[model samples]
Each structure stands twice: as C-alpha cells, then as structure tokens.
Target: MSRMIFVNLPVENLDRSKRFYEAIGARNEPKFTNEAAAMMVLSDTISLMLLTKPFYATFTSKRIADAHSSSQVLLCLSCESPAEVDQLVEAASANGGKADPGPKQDIGGMMYGRSFEDPDGHHWEPMWMDPQMAEAGAHPVESATAVSN
Candidate 1:
C-alpha cells in the first residue's frame, strides 16, 4: 500500500477554514469531521486535518505559534503547469486567502511557483516544473552545486 500524508493544521475558525479549502478544490471527508475538526481531502494521497485551536493544543504541550505572526512551515503542492499554479493562487485569493504572501519563483524556465496564505495564515505554495527538465535531473539544486564545485 502507498503511504498517505495527513497534514494537521490549527485553525482559528473551523467553518471558515473548511470553506476556504473547499473553494480551493478540497472536499470534506465527513467520516472524520466534527465541530472541532474537519478532514479535507486535497488529493488521493494528501489530506488535511483541520483542528480547532483548542483541539490542536491538546496534541502538544508547547504553545501554538500564531501563524499570522510566525511561520512554522511552508507547504507546497505540485502543479501540471505554470498556468495551473497561477490558477490555484488566484482561486485562493478569491476565497479569503492572501495571494503571493511570498515571492514568486521562476528558475530559468525549469520551475515556476507562487505562494498564498490561507485564512488562518497557513502558507501554501503551488509549483510546476518542466517535465523534460525534471526527467533529466536538471533542477536548481544540482545546477548550483555543479557551479560551485
């Protein structure tokens, strides 16, 4: 069986966060949803567990970081093309997310990406890469290492 990833996020408002994810194409999995939490399926393998702040806190002893003021992580999704990346970012912006919260990226036509922040300030990046370049293993990291060596 293939492994699946469930990203657990703390949400200030469950309903609003659920709606925002739905607007961006995630579907709710009712089997795991309640007033305090929601299971938003982003793809066959990727799911998001949106937990209310108090509910989230119960999982750990450390104080929750205010995502709006401090970033704990940056999540990224792969896209089919640069246009698809742009489309997702636009949809996020129209649905209460802040578009381009981080700088846009274009790596010599090999990669293109943009970022957005959800209503609760979770950062998401949608990115695309040239298939041929990827298959050839010509990503930026390898190129930079080669140049430095």
Candidate 2:
C-alpha cells in the first residue's frame, strides 16, 4: 500500500469548514469524518483531517495560530494549470473567502505556485510544476501539479 499523508487543520466550525471545502469540489469521507472532524479527500491517497478547534487544541500546548489577525504558516496544494489556479481562487472568493492580492510567480520552467486563504485565514497554495524538474530518480511529489505542456 502507498504511504498516505493526512494534513490536519484546526477549524472553528467543522460543519462550516466542510461546506467551504465542498463548495470548491472536495468530497467528505464519511468513513473518516464526523461532527468533530471531517476527512476531506484531496485525492485518492491524500486527505485533510479537519478537526474542531477544541479537538485540535489537544495536539499542542502552545496556542493555535490565529487565523483572523495574523498567520504564521501557509498550506500549499498543487493545481492542474494556471487557469485552474485562477478558477480555484475565484471559487474561493465566491464561497466567502478572499485573495492574497499578489502576483503569480514563474520559476523558469520548474514550478509555479499561488496562495490563498480560507475563511479562517488559513493559507492554501496552488502550484504548477514541470516533471522534468524531478530530482535525479525520485518518483514525484504526491501533491499534483499543473503543467504547461
């Protein structure tokens, strides 16, 4: 079996966050989701464990990062193309989220990534990449990437 990674996020409202993800075409896995948290399936092997704030608080002694006033971290996800990047950003806006108001980056034939923030101010990045940029004999990053060609 392939090694799967689950990124867990602290959300204020499990149901609300679930709806936001659903608005952007993500599906919830009932087998791993409930009122306390929702398993957002980003792909076949990648999932997000969206845990409620109190539930998430158990994971750390330090306070959870504030998602409204300031952000100390940014979560990045890959997109299929530059267009998909734009579309996802737009969708986020329509679903009560906002843009980061920055320029798109071109990494000279290697990669391109854009960032967005959720309703709670958690950052999400959409990146496009080229397979030729793979390191030596590595397979690839589990996160999907958008390619020009």
Provide TM-scores for the models.
0.92, 0.79
lDDT of 1 by residue, 57-149 (tens): 999999998989999999999999999999999999999999998888877677888999999999999999888878878545466321110
Model 2, 3-23: lDDT tens digits are 898888888888888988888
Query: Which residue pairs does candidate 1 place in steric collision?
Result: none
Clashes of 2: 1
> Which residue segments of model 2 deviate by more than 4 Å?
101-103, 108-110, 134-149
Off by over 4 Å in 1: 138-149
Compared with the true structure, all predictions reach lDDT values of 0.91, 0.76
Please give the clash total of every predicted structure, in order: 0, 1
